[model samples]
Target chain A: MAGERVQPATLSRSEAALVASEGKAPRTERGRKTLRAILDAAAIEFGEKGFHEGSISGITRRAGVALGSFYTYFDSKDAVFRALVRDMSDQVRDHVAPAIRAAPDQIAAERAGLSEFIAFVRGHKEIYRIIDEAEFVDPESFRLHYATTADRIAARLKAGAARGEIRADISDVHAWAIMGMNVFLGLRYGVWQDDVSPEAVADSIAEMLARGIGTK
Target chain B: MAGERVQPATLSRSEAALVASEGKAPRTERGRKTLRAILDAAAIEFGEKGFHEGSISGITRRAGVALGSFYTYFDSKDAVFRALVRDMSDQVRDHVAPAIRAAPDQIAAERAGLSEFIAFVRGHKEIYRIIDEAEFVDPESFRLHYATTADRIAARLKAGAARGEIRADISDVHAWAIMGMNVFLGLRYGVWQDDVSPEAVADSIAEMLARGIGTK
Candidate 1:
């Protein structure tokens, strides 16, 4: 059942392009920074007021960029919202990539990924709101975000299996299971409350992954 | 880190009462069936058009009930949406509870729960849209739904541990992890596609629970 083809992460260039509105891709370094500002401000606007109530002006005000700059990069509130969803998805991948890369093995890679993810989420609590809102605001983006994330995870796990660092039987089910564990764990430890540290959360998950949770 | 208290599922009567709008609880068997009809209709309405576009009239029309019947059970569209969120949550619990109760062990119980859950999602695909929309439309219900579900899972795991059917170290983390896995797996195999059987998905998870996925 695990024979499905897994795509490489480098194909994200097309994804980055998708993050920009039609005819709105930035050409210069300054334009890129302004686009970044608009997306960040959007995160706050939609995150706080939701999609219907959130306006382009609110994003521009928070971004401190002119209305013209906003229009130059985004067609409208909906466009920017879609862009923000993709951007947030990218932000999480970028934030967690280094830790995942630095880990010594597959299990440790997952641990580092979760720890870094929780830390990132704590700093960007608005992330959950933005991403969750995408489910209603832009269904396609919502679907794409999870689909790509799960695909990336499956690809990585498959590589680890080939290297003999992970169970050879690892498949999409394991990938989705790991992703789900990281997501809920992040929601509980990162967004809702912070009584526990990220390292501690990662440690518990690492132990669980190292051995089954059965009593036998 | 896993010492948090997990309340029992029986506390859901208070939750059900909380789901109803003020002065809208059904008092008779007929009223209860009417209320059930309204909720089922609301699921289709919201599921098809979303919260904003879904209307009481659409729901009443689908339910083949009178307009007064909707008002008899719900104060407004918002009230019914909130109620619907809780209703879906309860529907899932009631749907999965029997299988869980009939299992021979905690791990089997979990397997049964996931299998039943996926099957339920397949039949009630609207559930994802309605429950996810609650995050924006009715934030409290959304939080309550997840918090209650996680608490129930934790409580079950704790009971299983006491009975020597599960690892004693199980706690909120494990509960959340399991819930997360079941949810994503459902989204993938249940809502997104049906190429894989529910039994296959549940079996994979049951094996993972029985033994860790680590190469060693």
Candidate 2:
């Protein structure tokens, strides 16, 4: 998941938000903070109220920034929402990258990635609503989120195969399968309820991937 | 998914539609046919036009039924949409049940289910749009759709494990992982495009579930 993780290497919050924003990137530390604040606020706004009911004023107020400062980073509500989606997408990739990179094998890396992703969802419960809403709010962003995620997963699977860590015949099918598993698993265990620990869910799935569910 | 497939057994289209509709099931054969026509038209109306843009009158127009006939089955637009979601959910399960029941083992059953589901989606691309829009139009129906699907999957998995076809440690985690895999795989191979055959996608996933993705 890490080797093919979307976005450039070593991206900051400001940089990620900038990817979705139409405006120029902030120059100073304070400017970066404001942009970060706005993105986070947008996540909460859209997450709680959804895209249509969610307002730009609500985001600015939540960020504790003036409306003008909001405009400085994002041109309009749509711009900020798009930027927020990109920001959240990068946040997940970044959040799970280290654990994935540290894993001993491709299978272990995926386990680490899924475990980390679920844990991330538990903390940012709004992620599902935000990304799901983008399907109707910003169709392109929605596709880009899944498309890039799958691309990264496919990249790592290819790399894993190259290293003889996984099966040699990896393709988009497997990547999408894993991606969907992570998304829905996160929704069920992380957001909907936490009755099951992230490690438990990941461990079960990891076992399936390692030896499969079929009788030996 | 057959052994534990939700809804009553041997459900007709009218019965399936009745599960969602607040009104009573059509009493006569002619009434049932009218109800079926309304539901089919709703699919086309909501599928092509979406829930909000979709109108009750539009549905009646498409079905070639009178407005009174539409009101006879559903009270409001919301009712029809909710009914549509349930109908679609039942449709998918029923569509795939025969192949699943015929499979020799759990893995084969899942493969058969996915293969059939993709084939189903290819013909009913509007499924994603309608079911997804349910999240906003009717949150309960949206939750019910997925929750029930996952439950049915969990049931089949448990039975599969009992028969020594799959791993004994099957739980919600495994069920969700498989359900998620099928959903996304269907979206990619079924709705997004058909360059890859449903059988090929199912075969690849079946191989993964059978032998695992990690190098032996």
Candidate 3:
């Protein structure tokens, strides 16, 4: 529900590599492309119709994957879902982190981060709906989604505090508060409407944080 | 499901009175109690099962009223939902306004308002689940809720501006933002979990607004 795919599993890169290698060999690059297609179709189907309503046959039809090959890649529908969430979470983290690194200062970092986050959400709106529904399918995914991003932001805030840039006394609780607010607001305003651009909403939120409600 | 009671209608007071009065003798206090019991039962059933899962039979059973008597107060389940939302909205407003009025200063009024709002939600947590779920059942009810609360806070902000307590240029949009943030945060931290006291959460928010997030 935090706008991207998430997993509770803390698989290391090596473990992920081993799992990828162990998966049934789809002999050609074309076969690999088909796997990606299946994941994408599954995400849309699950998100729109929900877990209970989305059918494996419908998903295979949408992806143009052979029904037999679905078993080759995943143990079951749940496995496909777990894989999709992890992939999406990785994609989101990769998409947003570099933008933060590119900015020269705290304020600029926040601006870049917000803009990139908004752009990411706009670009992958469908996957977000799936992620939002993850709470019902597997609550741990939702909890991990918040925890991953909250931990990231909390780490940064802690670093800033150590450097004397942020208030020393501010708790990780407040960091989570900011993270939680931005997330829920993005879900409500970004995913659900076209009236306001995500970029504009992101800017407004960045402004609220960098300054706040009080007059400067 | 927000784990609270919510319904999908926005009935004005006169409309509610008209609906409640339908098919009931005016002198019958028993009728009034039966009507309230039906509404309360509806709230519980909706909260537990959501709009799609809740049935009129279940509601009447919970209310301990004859199944036929259900139609005496409401035309359908939807009507009952409308009445429930309207009733809760009025109850929340009634609970908050007097406390605000009795406070000694604007800050006190604000604090009182937040406390009363929290207390109201705590008191009616079950009913709140029904209202929150109504967001999906009917967007109009949610929209009416946002607009009503925004207008109230906007008026208060205007008063604060006139008294030179707040920045004059602050818009109703900001009022909406504050109202949205406070209410949602309360829902997340208060009703969702009791990890923090509602008063502390309100104080943190109130303090943030008053002093801003910058170095003092």
Provide the TM-score for each candidate, comma-separated: 0.90, 0.91, 0.74
How close to the true structure is residue A190 of candidate 2, measured as C-alpha lDDT? 87
| lDDT string, candidate 2, A1-216, tens digits | 111223323346558446535546777767777777777777888888888899989988988999988878777888888888888898999889999999988888999999999988888888888888887779899989999999999999889888877777789999999999999999899888999999999988888876642222
lDDT of 2 at A11: 41
Rank order by DockQ, top first? 2, 1, 3
- Which lDDT tens digits does candidate 1 get at residues B1-216? 001112212323344356567877766666776776677778888998999999999999998999998888788999999888887898799889999999988888999999999988888888988888888888888889989999999999889888887777777888888888988999999889998899998988888886652221
Q: Where's the lowest-lDDT run of ten residues in candidate 1 chain B? A: B1-10
CA lDDT of B121 in candidate 2?
85
Q: What C-alpha lDDT does candidate 1 achieve relative to the native structure?
A: 0.81
**TM-score winner between candidates 1 and 2:** 2
Cα deviation at B79, candidate 3, in Å, is: 4.4
User: lDDT tens digits, residues A67-97, model 1?
Assistant: 9988887787888998888888997898899
- Model 3 preserves the real interface contacts to a fraction of 0.08
Clashing pairs in 1: none
The interface RMSD values of the models, given in order, are 2.4, 2.4, 4.0
Clashing pairs in 3: B4-B129, B4-B130, B5-B129, B5-B130, B5-B131, B6-B129, B6-B130, B6-B131
- Determine the TM-score of chain B of model 3: 0.82
Chain B TM-score against the true chain B, candidate 1: 0.89
TM-score of 3: 0.74
Model 1 regions lying over 4 Å from their true place:
A1-18, A212-216, B1-19, B213-216
